[model samples]
Target: MVEPRPDQKKGLKERCPELLEIARLVSWCMNRDYLIRSCLDHINRRLGMRARCVLKEKEQLKLHCWLGEYECRMEQMPICKESIVWKVVEEGIPVNLTETHQCEGYSHTLGEKVKIKAIVPLWYADQVTQEEKRVGALIVDSGKMGMPVSDEDFEYLKVVGELIGAAIGKAELTEQFIDSYKRKEIMVRETAHAFRNRIAAIGGFSRRIAELARDKDLANEAKMIYHEVQLLESHLEQFEKYL
Candidate 1:
């Protein structure tokens, strides 16, 4: 494993903008798929590497985003203890490898041999357990047989992983919140509809009482009730527009 050193200030300066842009994405991006795709694009484009993202679902590692050299048809694969993905994902460690084919379950992740690969995991807290857990992994294939991936690239990838994990996690949570809110809005609309019907019924009865009442005071009271019902109905209609 190679450690990331910030020895070159120029390189760090150049990457600062990318990191800031990714941070903005993390803060505001609400769509899970779009956030992952956009983050992978930044990593691949800036580093000139083929990258892919894998997410954990139902105890299986599934491919979520691919920015590879060729088309991808492969899908989900079981998580083995020995696979590089598990090393990074379950253990919360990043690994830079020279021969990815030697790693167990490499074929399931990417169908071809990668000259060099950097794998980093995305971690999140479990909603029920409240324990820290990994959500996914980000893999970047860089360099050729002769050149090897740069140390600077590895450092940049490490930084990218730290933020990307949170961005993806937040996006997922945002989606869940939106779905829950929509369901509540539907319930509100239904309840409001029922209340509006009751108001209309009361208004009709009040109007009838006013028409039949012989006493002026009784008729005036009925008309007041009818007028109040009309105002309430109007207010309910305006409130429903928000939901």
Candidate 2:
């Protein structure tokens, strides 16, 4: 792992409190949006810079959450193929760049003068494929000219990216589980309803046949059919209730 710069290491003692808070916040957050928002808020508060979390949505890099003074026109917009964010996503590595103009797409959208300190890619394993994927990037900018990004800040952002990735992966799995459960529930409900309707129809017809039967044997058989239908109806009711 890359180590923090010597000057950044000197201030690590003073950053412990914020680090602890971030740890607590990340651990407690299960929702993707909440986790990203809280993480960005914490980083912005501690660093006094604009922080944004952008997630990949289909082909676009949509802004998931953000904090501070930077205007995010790229929110919900497609990430340009030539942009730095795209580069980080493609490389699956953290990048520190002082000049925004070097990234053509980023400069075109946000402007050439926009000051960006670093962009860190957030990665998570796909639930279905189990393959590692770059889900998004955390972009941090000082919003001022020539502010060098510190190694400690980069290290902290990397940790935040990992936490966000884990949270997003867990949340996606949870959603899939919930959706599967709902589908099963709907199937059960529909099956139960259809079974109940069929049983009710059989019971009704048998009861009517029993009433109209002239022969005692025929009446008794019809009554027995109704009784069996009633039992099946009771079982279906129980099954529906269990579901």
TM-score of each: 0.73, 0.81
Candidate 1 residues lying further than 4 Å off, grouped into runs, are 1-14, 24-31, 70-82, 99-108, 113-116, 124-133, 143-151, 214-217
Q: For residues 84-136, could you state the per-residue lDDT of candidate 2 as single tens digits?
A: 67778888989887555655445333543454568889888887898998888
Best-performing candidate as measured by lDDT:
2
Instruction: Provide the RMSD of all predictions against the true structure, rounded to 1 decimal.
Output: 5.1, 4.6
lDDT of 1 by residue, 1-243 (tens): 122234422265588988899988888777778888898877666666677888888778777777745544545555444566766787898887765455645443444545367788888775657777688888887434323456677788888888887776676677788999999998998999999999999999999999999999999999999999999988998998877
Any runs in candidate 2 off by more than 4 Å, and if so which?
1-20, 71-76, 98-108
True lDDT of residue 54, candidate 1: 87
- Using alpha carbons, what is the TM-score of model 1? 0.73
